[model samples]
Target: MPRPLRSENLQGTLDLLVLKTLAARGALHGYAISTHIQQVSDDFLRVEEGSLYPALHRIEGLGWISSEWSTSSTNRRVKLYSLTAAGRRQLEIEQKRWDELTLAVKKVLECYG
Candidate 1:
């Protein structure tokens, strides 16, 4: 099996994943967002708290997302993050770029391997 993906390997795409996750799931806390990414990738990708929290704060400052403090189901306090209108628009742009990048990578692998 392939080695698990670390957050350092996802430097440029974390914001895209976070935005898409919020877009599809509505508001979610940092841990939930991290869980969603790991689960959906079938455990291939693991997002650590160190990287996730900073990305959350950075994305929020960009105005693409917003957050509020809320109580979780376990009665613990958490910061809930949701995508903004601007984020939805940015998601489209990010998706296109991702698609193009993957396609280029696929072409190279198909030719050389």
Candidate 2:
């Protein structure tokens, strides 16, 4: 059996992922954010706690996202993260960057291979 490619180096795209996820799914807790990314990517993208929480905090610090304390289904206090207007704008920027990056990679692949 072949091994699945490890996407651990996806740190560069973490901000875009979080922003897009919150934009699409509305507000979600930290763990929910992690799981959502993994599930959406068919388990190919795994956001570890060591990586995710920091990104969440950094994004909140940038004022791209707002956090609120909310009770979860399990009756535990959780911080819900939601996208802000700035985040939406950032999402657009990130999307553009991603598109350009993919296009560039495709060109390199076509030229070299």
Candidate 3:
């Protein structure tokens, strides 16, 4: 079974996950993105809609993402989000940073362990 996520750990990783999801899936609405993350994590991570919306808006503002109103699978109107070309570039950069940070953290833990 998957362990529960630590919010502090998740905080640093959320953006990468979002960007990766958008890259892989093309476009997804906010709720779908949240559900995808949760499912992918095997329900170990829980994302609040409030936090998700603000993050989406922030990414959109950063020009890393874009959104448009569209009908969901349920035929309900929703704002669909997709990664921009800039976002794809940003994801590569961010992913590199994440890998470096995780390696550093792992090294530190190894030293102490």
Candidate 4:
């Protein structure tokens, strides 16, 4: 059975997803980032602007990402976000941790089941 999606769970995974998305898709604006996440997750994940912007700021502060103002196709100014080298390195470490954590959880669940 698929696990239920919970807010707390989503919050924890959002950063990882964001980093992976930028790594794969290159630079993207906030809305594009949210849309990509939603689309890729088949609507399972929705990155609200309130949550998304703050997360972006936090990651940028962490040197995992950087942003610059750019004009969108519609000629509106938007901040385009891209992963930094540090961010790429962080993503690798986080990916390992995520894999280990999920494997442990799966083992625990299977053991109890």
Candidate achieving the largest lDDT: 1
Better of 2 and 4 by lDDT: 2
Per-model TM-score on C-alpha atoms? 0.96, 0.93, 0.90, 0.92
Residue pairs with clashing backbones, model 1: none
Candidate 2 lDDT over residue span 26-74, tens digit each = 9999999989888888777888888889889999999999999999999
Q: What global local distance difference test value does model 2 have? A: 0.90
State each candidate's clash count: 0, 0, 0, 0
In order, candidate lDDTs are: 0.94, 0.90, 0.87, 0.89
**Best TM-score goes to which candidate?**
1
The regions of model 3 sitting more than 4 angstroms off are: 1-3, 6-9
Candidate 4 steric clashes: 0
Candidate 2 ranges beyond 4 A from true positions: 1-8
Better structure of 2 and 4 per TM-score: 2
Cα-based lDDT at residue 51, candidate 2: 85
Better of 3 and 4 by TM-score: 4
Q: What is candidate 4's lDDT per residue for 1-113, written digit by digit as tens?
A: 35435334586788898999999999999999989888887777777887888999999999999999999999999999999999999999989989999999999999999
Consecutive 10-residue window with the lowest summed lDDT within model 1? 1-10
What tens digits encode model 3's per-residue C-alpha lDDT throughout 1-113? Answer: 86777434578677888899999888999888888888898888877787788889999999999999988778989999999999999999999999999899999999988
